[model samples]
Target: LLGIARFKALSSLRKKKEDWIDDDDAAQVPDSADTPEVVTMKEDKAAALRRFVDALPEEHRTVIDLAYYHGQSVTEIGEVLGIPVATVKTRMFYARKKLGEALKAAGYDRGWP
Candidate 1:
């Protein structure tokens, strides 16, 4: 009985996460009130990432979508994608580098991390 109950709870949690993804897909961008660069840096990143999604490779794009849009942790993303956590982090690293290049080429003066 306890095993079945645990299974049911896990199933419900997975469904909830799926529902959240659907909602995220429907979410539209909101205009942020401009402030200083430091303040914007902390909160503006998700928006920035969304804007650059099309430029990402499918693997990096899916990982980021799971993490940000689906509100998943790195470990969760790893589990979902059947990859190790280290690999997920590597993809994120390369993804950031790619985005940095694109942004710089577009004339945005985003400073180094």
Candidate 2:
């Protein structure tokens, strides 16, 4: 029932898109339409990042989230968490290395969006 309603919602959304975009931008979409440069990376990059976060150790996740997702400085995160700056730095390092390793293992190092 939820899925059906969601599908209907999406069906309505597709119709609504016609109103949101002008004919010029509508034609620009690839097959459907092309995305704007503001989007930067494609959906693959977002999926890869999600996978990286899921595979990371829990303890390091906070540091990674703070530094990568929130744009917080390592020192700022340390201050917020009441941990030493070095510990925060170490966590950030390990988190990045682990995410890199995970992404590499998934065969996404070079071809990721």
Candidate 3:
């Protein structure tokens, strides 16, 4: 029963996330009222990054989504995907490197924290 309930909750959250993706107006904005210039620049960068991530190979994209979107740890992603933890780590590493290179090619100069 508990497992079923958890699944239902996760399903609902997934649906909401999908809806947010489909609706650009649903994106969260800063409360401090960012200037139009800053907002446009940020949006452009975000769109570029998203395109890069979407272009990743399936395995790398899966790891990236599970880690960042679903907020799963390396071990958790491995368990969910039925892969070894080392594989998860490797996918993440490669995904990040690919994304970094793509972003650089897109002229994104901001350093990662």
Candidate 4:
């Protein structure tokens, strides 16, 4: 179920490439302008990051989802998961390390968003 959902989300992201904008480029676009290469680069980085996050181990991914996606603090995550706060912090640390390594290896080592 999760895989299917992720696939659908990624497919939609690819289809709606122009909707993927950084904060600096959020202004309305003129119809006369061509789609810039920078847009493609942003999409590439987004796709790469998504792929890496999805490929993470379940434990690591859960920590990432709770902390980043759901905006949970370490203490909050620990409470929700019925684990110690220290454990939550450790999982987050390892998850971030793995994600950083994966993103760097995919040639998106700099300028995140």
Output the number of the lDDT-best candidate: 3
Go through the candidates in order and give the clash count of each.
0, 4, 0, 0
Give Cα distance to truth, residue 43, candidate 3, Å. Answer: 1.1
Can you give the TM-score per candidate against the true fold? 0.52, 0.59, 0.66, 0.63
Between candidates 3 and 4, name the one with more favorable lDDT. 3
Error of 3 at 113 (Å): 12
Which stretches of model 3 miss by more than 4 angstroms? 1-33
Clashing pairs in 1: none
**Cα lDDT tens digits for candidate 2, 1-113:** 99999999999988874447889998887773446642456566677878779778887988888888899997899998999999998988888888778878776664535
Which candidate number maximizes TM-score? 3
lDDT of 1 at 102: 73
lDDT of model 1 at position 34? 56
- Residue-by-residue lDDT tens digits, candidate 3, 1-113: 99999999999988884323434554555367778888888888888877888999999999999999889999999999999999999999999999989988878965631
Question: Each candidate's lDDT (Cα)?
Answer: 0.77, 0.80, 0.86, 0.84
Task: Say which prediction, candidate 1 or candidate 2, comes out ahead on lDDT.
Answer: 2
Candidate 1 minimal-lDDT segment of 10 residues: 17-26
- TM for candidate 1 is 0.52
**TM-score ranking, high to low:** 3, 4, 2, 1
On TM-score, the stronger of 3 and 4 is: 3
